[model samples]
Target: MKKKLVMMLLAACVMVAGCGKTAVSDNFQNSDAKEQEEFQIEVESKIEQEKCFLCGDAEDSLMGYYSKKESIGIVHLNSLYVSETRVRDFDDDGNELFQQGGSSTMVNSFGEGYGSVAIHGNPDRGYTNIDVSVSDKDEVDFELLEDRLCQICLDTLADFYEDQINSGDNENNGCSGYCLIDFQTKELHRLSEPYSGYTMGDYYVKYDIWKEGGGSDWHRISVFIAYLPERVASGN
Candidate 1:
């Protein structure tokens, strides 16, 4: 009975040792795997930072924004007509008085003005009209704004085109280019093209706006823009 008990005890001891060895081995493997994962993440983050630097980080970009005090409008005229008629007012006793008569002018929030000539009393007849409006405050600085907007637009368009190219959709490829307008000069230039070896893309970021229609109408302007090169680059 004593010898049988001794053999059983030794078997139990061997089982406990085997379990301990397995537990230790598993812990080491888990820790090693965690370290490797952390290292990989660090390496990837560094790569991304490098890419950001190459792509002209936010500091080195031009940006644009809609002027807060400005609005835009569009007008369409089909014909030239004018008429002067006394506007009448009627009281309970069929009385008539003269009201001011000239022309009706529509002013948009941006201070743009539109006037249409009364070709006839009929709305169907088209008339020549003048569309004018105060440009956005940003318009005065349009050259700067344009460059920034174009650059950003190019970057975005590039990404969009690349995605489309990958998906095999290249229908509007010509629209991929960027354009900057100098309101003062009334000049429009392509981002890819350089005037005096200074391409707009090199100086400005991109911005986008959503206008309702092509006709002359006041539009809500939304802008996303960047700054001219890095302030650090400018030493300011």
Candidate 2:
């Protein structure tokens, strides 16, 4: 069952690229520590800028998420929501937590129809990628799927923000370190790492949207999770 979910996510995420790196000439894998560090700094800077755009709904900004050939937008803070789950943190008074397919689900944010969508990420499935071809004929259902995946991604991001506030790592601007998680095939990924900053346990929620005003055009969505850095180090 877990495998099937991951596969579906992978397929949805890839969109046109089909769940693989987007043929980058400067792959981060070959980048050394210094280069990676510099890249991280760049990513962090971009995240802050993008956050500002989201806060004020700046339509002129260019830092948006993407799939193969579609532009994806980060969920505006106003159009985001979260739910709690039974997964206890065990470190903080045994309170329940929100995990993929566990304690939380999506409950509507935008487009006047998407309400309470649920999708799960395999905890064991570290950084993963998927490849599949998508057609425009299913654009209606495509938006629904993209909205749900993005909602999950935003909720995961909200969790990251909460974690930051709890750990005294608070930032007034925006949050970072988020990527999509795919558990189906243990594939090597680079483009999935949207933000170059030092992100912790997070995943990518990808989609393709018409890069137009208000970000309401329908395309596709890709919501994936990144593999832990340690896992990447060991070449898993």
Candidate 3:
């Protein structure tokens, strides 16, 4: 797959143990050994002009890579290791229910914001098929998230096409991708492969919003994005 090949190349270039990297750099071609560690471009912050993708913890190895103030809507995993999981359905009072009908520890979530992000298996395939999620938060706007995902899909598709044209590869055989979750509709929406957004799913861009998790706060709005590896590795 294009994403896999790109990631392999990236790993070779950076000498990282795994295939995880952040998207702070404006373009991929400019990433160098030193720039990858120190951060590339300086993205402007939304809450305050001073806030930035690089404004967060500096010591956190992966989280600090391309992450700034917070993980996108989904919490960022500190490492690139895929979490262990089990997705099996059983009967409840003689009625069979989807294993995902309820939450499980297998979500493979990382950090916390309004909610954390998780990925489970598909209703059909066991571990092979996966879906991502954002744990329940006091406040969430499904409509807004849906809209933003649509826009991101379009942007990603555009990038894919541009890359294809530039590379003169008309064939798209290896770029199988994942779909985004629509909290409003409670359904899966196909996300264009290699979303234009950050690869780690740990940065909260403009489309992502989070409420403080302090004393008393209600109106939960946490989103769990299913599917990884695919989301992280774009075919570009």
Best by lDDT: 3
Report the C-alpha lDDT of model 2 over 1-236, residue by residue, as the tens digit: 00011111223223433335565334432332121111111011123322333222234422221111111122322233221111112213322233434222223233343322233323233332222111222112212222223333334444444333333422211222212222112111211112223332333423221222464332222333343334344556
Q: Highest TM-score, which number?
A: 2
Candidate 1 worst ten-residue window by lDDT: 36-45
lDDT of 3: 0.28
Alpha-carbon RMSD, each predicted model: 26.1, 20.4, 20.9
By summed lDDT, which 10 consecutive residues of candidate 3 come out lowest? 36-45
Question: Tens-digit lDDT track for model 1 on 1-236?
Answer: 00011112223334434464455554554444422111000011122321231122334421111111011111111110111111112233334323434334333232224222121111112111222221222122222222333343334434433432333323322222223333112123322211112323323322222233576333222212222334454556
Give the alpha carbon lDDT tens digit for every residue of 158-216 in model 3.
Answer: 34434433343223211212223221121223222223233323211111222335743
Clashes of each: 24, 30, 21
Ranking by TM-score: 2, 3, 1
User: What's the TM-score of each model vs. the native?
Assistant: 0.17, 0.24, 0.19
CA deviation > 4 Å runs, candidate 2: 1-76, 82-118, 127-217, 231-236
Better of 2 and 3 by lDDT: 3
